[model samples]
Target: MNLLFKKKDTTMKTIFLLLLILIALNIQLTNAQPTSKYHAKLVALDNVYEGDVDLNLYGQNPSLVKMEWTEISPDSTKKTIHRVQYDMEAVLSFIIDKDTFYVKNLVDDEEKVRPYYLVRKVYGNDIVALYQYTSKEGVKRIYIGLPRRDPYYVQHPFFTDGTNMYTAFVYFKDCDALYQKMKAEQDGYWFKKGATDEQCVSIWKRIIDEYMNCKK
Candidate 1:
């Protein structure tokens, strides 16, 4: 009788342990599911798509964009989840939360094209744009894109020392004059020691507006 009771107790403990393990696995799987959605515009498609969008990278370069969304039929009777992948070149832009991102072609010193998402667009138009990119390693870079010119990296004036100061103002072929003008004004106090990030962004917007006016 004593042996039988001991065996029963042991079995009960084993069952409880197994149940706990199953519960832990279920929780982990639930947490692993993707939940965030984005608004995306593709170069090939005219209509905008609202979905869960991911930038799939291949060896540190963006190879494609994966999108998943549910479509409801016209009759409102059926809903199907659709999953699609687009080549990196096919994606024009996407908005996650409230921030907009554009596809930027990053060219190396050897002139090879490496595509990455421009994380932020400080200023942009048909003719020229200023964009910021954050790499996988969390390094941030600023870029200026212009017609007939390769998208080139520029030293961020607010974040770095004023070395290569003119690079930040190279929005046009004749921007040398504008750079000199801003330089005289201390480049909107960007070179000031211990300037806050918010202050720097405000100064950049003002300078970009001034530069854009010169192009008009």
Candidate 2:
């Protein structure tokens, strides 16, 4: 009877220890992952964009592209002006692939008529994409603040594949978190020179992996 009692106590202790270890691991995992709000945002965004047309096709053929910048006057007013020229025919040809495109809020001709293909251009190692938002003053603003080098290196807060509507929206939504991860993993600095397609894609794949893992 004494031996059986001792064995029962030992088994109970072992089970208790295992439960404690499992609890600790759950806490660690919860702390390591992103906040509940971010996860909720991801879920909401994924659902919103799931069935939309894949804009990747537009980026595949970027024949005509243009760059733009923001100009703030002394009066504290801001305006986005075209920094480079564009070919209307080239822009039109690209858009002709799809019947039509629309923006949620058509504030101006720029955002209304302009297709993603014309506004987001990829150079050797850099991507310049138009970012538009409604300002506090109730005006639509646009700008392309691209880095001279591989924007990914500096954790540029824009998508490298902005021409892809879904991907770009996801990048814009999670840019800060993604940038922090990239900066921490890549020696905490941005690349000083242009990056090749292979290089950029490899880095992006890692970023995507990290994101998906966290989601899991």
Candidate 3:
């Protein structure tokens, strides 16, 4: 009986060892995939918001824009990982965090923060459009009240600059579905369920401006 029990224990250990090895291999394989170049971020921004955002019209927050991360494929391939958010009902205000910066060279006036979300547009029938800033790992995305600027007003626009808020003949319009698919793929490709974060934000600004005028 003792000899038979010992043999069973040895078999179980062997099976456990094999399972571990297989798991490791699967993880490696998952991390080895590559991604295609996605220009959807530019398309959405240009098509929807146009040049209505930013002080200089590049559509970026004119304040502190800390470098964030870019997404990587499971196989360590670089991914675009374009992101979008919708806060049709969220507030829009400035971020005023005191003591956000520590002392530098014994300066008397400590550094202050004044983060804010400039207006941006959403470009998909799936995800709602937002004027919020791109989110990083730990930083907070603060919103304040500004209902007049909400894109949800597409049905009854109260403002316009060009071919923007016109009812072609007579109808309310919103973002298209094709743009939704493109945006989805871009957002999901780099957002691994449990992987990298802010470190992946590409430092290059041109990357987000390529398709600034593409159709949905």
Best by lDDT: 1
Model 3, runs deviating above 4 Å: 35-216
TM-score of model 3 vs. true structure: 0.18
Tell me which of candidates 2 and 3 scores higher on lDDT. Answer: 2
Residue 56 in candidate 2 has what lDDT?
27
Full ranking by TM-score: 1, 2, 3
lDDT of 3 at 47: 34
Residue clash pairs of candidate 1: none
Return whichever of 1 and 3 wins on lDDT: 1
For every candidate, C-alpha RMSD to the true structure in Å? 12.5, 23.1, 22.9
lDDT of 3 by residue, 80-188 (tens): 5434342312222221121111111110112222222233332222122222232334332211111222222221121112232122211212224323433343442
TM-score of each: 0.50, 0.23, 0.18
Q: How many residue-pair clashes does candidate 3 contain?
A: 20
